[model samples]
Structure formats: C-alpha cells, structure tokens
Target: MEEFNWLQLLNPEFYILLELGGVKIGLFVVLFIVFAETGLLAGFFLPGDSLLFLAGIYSEGLMNQFSTHNDFLNVTIFALLVSLMGILGNMTSYWFGAKSGGYLYSRQDSFFYKKKYLYQSKEFFEKYGSKAIVFARFLPVVRTFAPVIAGIVEMDKKKFMLYNILGSLLWSFSMIFSGHYLHAFFLNEFGVDLKHYIEYIVIIIVLFTTVPVLWKILKKQAHIEE
Candidate 1:
C-alpha cells in the first residue's frame, strides 16, 4: 500500500472533491461551486475556473453525473448541466444586486466580502460595456461581482440573459473540454499523468487566473501615484 502525503490534501480533486464526494455526488459539488462562485458575494474564494478544468480530468466527461454511457452524450449532458448552474448562479447574483444595491454599497468589508472587488468589477463592466459579462466568466474575482454590477445598473433583462448564457456556456465548455482532451493527450502521447502533479497544476492554474487581476490593480495604483 502507498502512503498518502498530507500535502496532497490541499489538492481538491486528488483528495477532497472527488474522494469525499465520489462519482455519485462529486458532480453536485462541482455544480454548486460553479453556482456559488458566480452567485454569492463571498464565493469569490471558490476555485471555480480551475474546478471546471479539473472536473474534466476526474469526472471522465461527467458520464455518471448525467447517467450517460456514450462519450459524446456524456460530454454534452455534463457541459449543459454545468452551464445551467452557471447561468442560474448569475441570475441569482444579478437579482441580489438589483434588490440590495444600495445596502451593498454601504456595507463594510469583512473576511468574506470586499468592497474593492465590487468597485473594481464595476469599473470593468463600465469599461467593457455588455461584453464584460462574457469576459468576467474567465477572470476569477471579476466573475463573482460582474453580474452584481450589471444588476445594480438595471441592465436590460433580455440583454443580460443573452450574454449570461453565452458566457456560461463558453466558460464551462472551454475549461472542461480543454482539461479532458489535454489530459488525455499528455497521458497517451507523453505518458505524463496530471494527477501526479496536482499541486503544481493547482498553483499554475491559480497564478494564471489571478495574477492578471493583481497586476491590473498595481498598474492602476501606479497611474494614480503618477
């Protein structure tokens, strides 16, 4: 028997999400994370972007999640369900923002919620116009609050839903499919298993998703100082 390393405990796919939840319920964990990341203000900490990617590797195209045996069928069903969660999550966030926009603006920051993120996402939405809805889906913190900003502004429902659906599908499908096919390519062609380097993969994904946001903040501060 191989000894389990505690460090791998930090890797959700390697230990927590998949092992704890197993195939039967792991899919729900994935869906909930996706929903929360976009829908809840405090859900900004959720590793939604990376989870989608990792799901492809561990979920095996979510075959069991949707009760499908065919390869294409499984992928389609899994992607759609994931997208639905994202869409619904955005709608929930938007609704919350619409109802409590003033209170949110006055609320104090805490461990889970930050007003800066809201302001930053507002700037992003203002700068990008309606397209921010799509761009935010890939960016971590921005995605959490972009819909909120949209809602606060009272964006047209039809327009918001249009971009929301497009953004959710593109983000979910791209991440999952890339993870699925890319993992297979590496394993089959080069014989490298991503699971072996889960920690490094997590670090890389985190950096890829977050560094840009930090950099932009730093650059804006520099401009202010100038």
Candidate 2:
C-alpha cells in the first residue's frame, strides 16, 4: 500500500530526483509525459492537468530544496515545453483520426469505444461542426471521443487540425500554468500550504469552465421545453 501510494506521486518524485540527480533527466520525463498524453489517444486517460499543476507546485519545492537560480525562469520554461507537447500530442491524435477515419470508429467492440461518448460525440459533430473540437477539449470524458468522432465523420483535415491543436494548447496549458502560478503566488503571499486545496482548485477550474456552458445548454433546454 505504501509503495502503491508512492507510485502515484511518480512524476513529482521523478521531478525531485531528477533535479537532485540532474536537470536534463527531470526535463526529459516531463516533456515525454506531456507529449504522450496530448498526442496519444491511448494516453487520453493520463493525468495531464494534475501533472502540470503538480509540476508547477514542485517547481517551488525544488527551489527551496536546492539553491537553484531563477526558479521562475525554470518553471516557465517547463510550462512552455509541456504546453507545446500537449499541442503536438493532440495534433497526432487528430491525424490519427484523419488516417483512421470511418474504419477505426466502425469497431464497436474496441475497448476504447464507449457507446454513450460516441453518441454524444456524434451529436456534437452534427450540431457544432468544427466548434465541437474546441468545446470538447474542456470536457473530461468527452475530450477523448471528440477527435475520434471527427475522424469518423471525415471532418476537413486542415480545419480539424487547426482547432484540435488550438483547443489542446488552451485547455492543457491554461490549467497547468494557472495551477503553477497560483501555487507560487499563494505560497509567497500567505506562507500556507496550498496542497490541501488542490482538489478544490481543480473543481473550481472545471466548474469555472463547465458552468457557463451548462447554463447555455439549460437555457436552450428551457426554450425548447416552452
């Protein structure tokens, strides 16, 4: 159980160990994870938001533990690299979607395919056209299927790629960098532990995004109900 618990903090642990062991090693792991999650469809489940957030928090810890110069500079570089990886990763997914097209989505039995999400993704593509790619990026489960649906529907490759990359960057980078900067600011200002608030911070961000979208949806619902 202890080993299991420790394993969950693997990225943070790696970051710390790498900083102590060598900066190059630490940076590489971070980049790899970022790219994998953003690009690989199978990697959609990986903890991208949390990893970036933790990376930001860990940056502060690394500064205190080591007499490192330019902590902010280092953190910013880390953030940018991860953000770029995220963009690149989703692009790969988009191309995969383009390449796979209808053939990939035809298999209902594939483990990654879920009836509910596929249906929803279908509805989204039918309703929103190119914008669904953008909107779906912020959704947890839906984001996974959005690209797949785009591929299945044979959405224009150039347009889908543009929106897919934009959405990926906006969603992944914004959450991560926000968490990092917030952690840095709060710690500097209050000298209190912000770790306890991580869940709330994430929830707040999810709601901050989801609520307004929901409101618009509800409003549309009520109009139809009338």
Candidate 3:
C-alpha cells in the first residue's frame, strides 16, 4: 500500500472520482458531502466550497445522470439540491449542539475534535447574533461549528431555520453558479476548459475562507503569550 498524499485534499474532484467514480450517483454524493460537512463534525475536513464549485462546473453532466434539462436550469436544480443538504446539515449540527453541547465543550480534543473551533464559532455567534449562521456559511471550519454553538445557546428554532435556509441557499447558489458560469464563460469565450485550472481555484477558495480564522487564532495565541 502507498502512503496517502495529503496534497489530494486541495482537489475536490478527487473525491467525486475516488468515492463515487462518476457512478451516476448524480446529486447523491454532492448532497451527502454537503450535509456531512455542515451536519457532521467528522465532515469538517471534507471538501465544501470546491465540491460545490466542481458541481457547478460539471452541473450539466451530474444532473444529466438523473433528469435531462437545459444547462442553466440543470445548474440551478443542482444548486437547490445542494442548498437543501446544507440546510439539513446545519439543522443536524444545531440539534446535536442543543442535545450535547455541554458535553462537547468539556470533551477533550482529539484527531476529530477541536474546542478552539467551537469557541471561535461561539464568538462569531455572540458578535453577530443570528446573522452568524449566514456569515459563517462562507467560512470553512466556522461554518461547521457555528450552528452547533447556536444550538448550545438554545437559539429559537424558527430563527435558526430562517437563517439556515437563507445561508444555505446563498452559499450553495453563489459557489455553484460562480463555477458554472465561469466554467462556461472560459470555455465558450476563450476555448479554455476550466477544469484544468480547478486546483488553483480551489486553493484560492481555501485561502480566502481559511485565512481570517487562522489570523484570529494566531492573534489570540499571541495575545495569550503576551
């Protein structure tokens, strides 16, 4: 057996190929991955933005597996389904937080858990109130834990649902459409296949979403040392 190359984490296309292998699972894997990342703590490490972007790029083909539709319509449908999963995922995390949030805070950190993330999410929730749900959707690790904090705090169910839907829809649609349109724009306008450049795009996205949290953590650690 070969040692796993951690570099593959940068490319979400790998999972779509490695796990589903283009098996016509269509939206199944996309929805599942979205749900897992937002809904399940273990899914924090799984690809999120990139997967949605890749889905956008390949939205037509992915959707064709189930039902045929116009290109834009196909991407729209894909985005909607992805949004649904994201919403559900957030709800799951919220429920877990409501049920076991106290336990989570006291639980020791391990390979699968990080209390700092939970705390950071708590900060965001405190600062932004309910809006953190929408704002955190754009952040990587924070997105996973924000709703959990909300649950732990016992935010109103109706309020959580409202922001969850709005956030999920905005996040999924923006990412997917950006990929879809950009992929098409490059190909149709410049004879470029955007998939060839997806790795770099994913890198940009990771940095874009991950930087602030990293900065905050580093800054907080520095403050503690001082």
Candidate 4:
C-alpha cells in the first residue's frame, strides 16, 4: 500500500486537466471544464486558456502512454473535440439565459449577480452586435457572459449558432494547436522539454489573455479623466 500525495494534487502544475490524462480520462475532463466555464456562471473563475494549452501539450504524452501513433491525427482529433465542447457550452449557456434571465432582471444586486456586470455585457452586445460572439471568445469574463446576454436579448438563434461555432473553433483550435506545435518546437529547436517550463508558459498565457481587459479599463479611466 502507498500513501496518497495530497501535496501533488495541490500543486498548481499538477492541474486536473493534466492529471486526467494519466488516468485515461483526459477527454472527459477537458469537455466538462469547457462546458462548465462557458455554461455556468459559477465557473467564471476557471483557468480556461491555460488549461486548454496544457491539455494540448500533455495530450501527446497521454496518447503515447496508450501506445498511440500518428501525433498529428491524434492532436487534430483532440482539438476538434475541445472545439465542440466550447460550442456546446456556449449553446447551453444561451439556453439557460433564455429560460431564466427574466428572474435576473427583477433580482437585486448581490455578490454573484451584479446588475452592473449584466449591464456591461448588454452594452458590449449592443456595441458589437453579433460580432461580439466571435470577439468575446478571446476575452476572459466576457467570453463566459456574452452568450447569456445574447439569449436574454433574444438574438436570432440562427445567427447566434453561426457565431458560436465560429468562435469556439477559433478559440479552441488556436490554443490547443499552438500548445501542441510549440511543445514540439521547443523540444526540437532548443533541445528543451516544454514540461520543464510549463509554469512560465502558463503565466505568459494568463498575461496574454488578461492584458486586453486591463487595457480596456485603463482606457476607460483615461477617457473619464478627460
């Protein structure tokens, strides 16, 4: 009998997404995270971008562990599955909004349900219209809430579906494939394994995703000062 390493589970690098691969349940974990992050308001704080990228990097090792060959094909399949998860998650969020958004309108502000946040999403949807769906995929909190706002406003379902699919494909494919290729590039060109530097890579990805939000806020403040 062996003692369980609880500390390993607590380590940031030991992300559940990576751990799932070891247990041969990576696909299920990835899909569930994607769905929760996009579909459930409570999931707003999930590390979506970093998780997806890490998944791509670890996926190759996972496949090899299972005696799989043809890295390209495996990675392609993985990317597609992640994309579908994102698309389905947004659709689920939209449906929930359509069914229950009315309740939110009458409710007062609370820790989780802030009228200001909803209003901000509404303003974003109005300013960008359908394009917001595609653009929001690149933004953090906005990505999670854009579909909900669209549903609340009753945007045309047909148009919403088109943008939702496009956004999900763009977001998921970009993150996952970039991780896959970059891992290979580092190993081949620099003779360094990506796993050794994954923490720094995750930090970079976090900053990349968050800089836009910070810039927007700074710009808004500057305008207010003017």
Q: What are the per-residue Cα lDDT tens digits for candidate 3 across 186-220?
A: 99999999888877888888888788879988998
lDDT of 2 by residue, 66-151 (tens): 43467667666556666677667666766776677665546675554455555655676678889888887676545666776777
Question: What is the descending TM-score order?
Answer: 3, 1, 4, 2
Cα lDDT tens digits for candidate 1, 33-152: 788887776456677777778887776634564566776567667888899999999999999989987777899999779988989999999999999999999998899999999999
TM-score of 3: 0.91
lDDT, residue 123, candidate 2: 76
TM-score of each: 0.90, 0.67, 0.91, 0.84
Model 4 steric clash total: 0
Q: All candidates' lDDT scores? A: 0.82, 0.62, 0.85, 0.77
**Candidate 1 wrong stretches, greater than 4 Å:** 1-10, 14-24
Clashing pairs in 4: none
Could you tell me the lDDT of residue 138 within candidate 4? 80
Error in Å for residue 158 of model 2: 3.2
Error of 1 at 186 (Å): 0.8
Listed per model in order, the count of residue pairs whose N, CA or C atoms clash below 3 Å is: 0, 3, 0, 0
lDDT of 4 by residue, 77-120 (tens): 77788788889889988998888867766779765456655666
lDDT of 4 at 68: 44
Query: Which candidate comes out best when scored by lDDT?
Result: 3
